[model samples]
Target: MLILAATPIGQAADASRRLAEVLASADVVAAEDTRRLKRLAAELGVEVGGRIVSYFEGNEERRTPELAAMLVEGQTVVLVTDAGMPSVSDPGYRLVVAAIEADVAVTAIPGPSAVLTALAVSGLPVDRFCFEGFLPRKSGERMRALTELVAERRTMVFFESPHRTEVSLRAMAEVLGEDRSAAVCRELTKTYEEVARGGLGELVEWAAGQEQGVRGEVTIVVGGAPSDSRTYAPEDLRELVAARQSDGLSRKDAIEQVAGETGTRRKDVYDAAHS
Candidate 1:
């Protein structure tokens, strides 16, 4: 059997009793960070009895099969990440696939999740929602990504690094509109946890005011486009492309952004822009 466990996103007290028991008794424990796993065990007042191995992004591809093999050998292998459930935005998806392929029974100990935490406190409608793991780091890629969500009517959740929060907010504002409602959740479930709710434009300003950049783990929640949102005309598409181009995107990327934003064919957007 393969157990995928969830670690506390912030406060150590949130670790479940089942998590403690599994950590102490699993035949093998694969953690995203061995050191953090040790610390967590210490906090639980339980000593892990299993062989501990590292299973993180840097080595997940190489380590997944090894963990799966242990499961095949009739060992109870437990997989865990530094925070949240394994295989979320964290490392564990590959191992899950490996376990399934190997006919290993896989299960999870549900616990804290930053995506759900942020959404709950976002003050936005959550009846329909989607989680967009993380925005692209590059400006053009990020803009294109946001443009694709411009017409998404479900509330959107995104994970972003602290340093890139401001830049991401600005890009979101440009592509999704400045007045779009959003919330920036930081250090969730921690001592300094904060959730800043406002328009995209307002969030951008708040992030900019942070002298050391937004700190700690961050999650972004943005309200969806209105159900009755207006459709874009060819001229409007061309204008949007021009705006993105002026913001330093290449002509090709700008066209892609406008096409995604308006759900127009890329060729049509190109023709409209050039016409």
Candidate 2:
């Protein structure tokens, strides 16, 4: 059997009872960070009795087969990441696939999740949503990626690095509309936990004005685009394209983003820009 347990994203007390029990008795424990796992076990007051093995992104490919072999040998294997559940923007998906292919029964211990936690507190409509893990790091790539979701009607969740939070918000404001609603959740469930809620423009300014700068693990929740497609005047599309250009997107990419968001033809946007 393969067990995927959820560890606390911040507060150690958030660890589930089943997680503690499993940690203490699994036949093989695969952890993204063995050191962190040991510390977490000590904090939970549960001495791990299983053979602990490192299983992280760097070694997941190599370690998966070994862990799966243990499962094939009838041993109970538990997979855990440094925080949250295994395999969520983490290093457990490969192992899960291996387990299933080996016909090992798989299950999970429900616990804290930064994705859902941020969404629930984001004050956005949670009726329908999507998790977008992390945005591309480069400005051009990031702009192109956000451009694809400009018409997305489902609330979007994203994990971002603290250093890039301000720039990301600025890019979002430029492409997704400055008035788009969003929330920046930082150090969730931790000592400095904070949730800054406002429009994308406001968030960009807030992140910029931070004297110490945005710090800690960050999750961004942006409200979905309005369901009804609104028509945009040629001039409006031109201004949108200019905004993206000022934010570092090339003229071509900017036109593409504006056309995509406004449902305008690329040629029309180009004429609007130069006309």
Off by over 4 Å in 2: 230-259, 263-275
Every model's Cα RMSD, please? 2.5, 3.7
Q: Which has the greatest TM-score?
A: 1
Model 1 residue pairs with clashes: none
Cα-based TM-score, every candidate: 0.90, 0.87
What overall lDDT goes with each candidate model? 0.91, 0.93
Report the Cα lDDT for residue 247, model 1. 82
Tens digit per residue, CA lDDT, model 2, 1-275: 99999999999999989999999999989998999999999999999998999998889999999998999999999999988988999999998999999989999999999999999999999999999989999987897889878988899999999999999999999889999999999999999999999999999999999999999999999999987657778888889989989988789988888877876778999999988
lDDT of 1 by residue, 146-180 (tens): 87888788999999999889989999998898999
Question: Residue-pair clashes per candidate, as listed?
Answer: 0, 0
Candidate 2 local lDDT, residue 108: 96
Query: Candidate 1: minimum summed lDDT over ten consecutive residues — where?
Result: 225-234
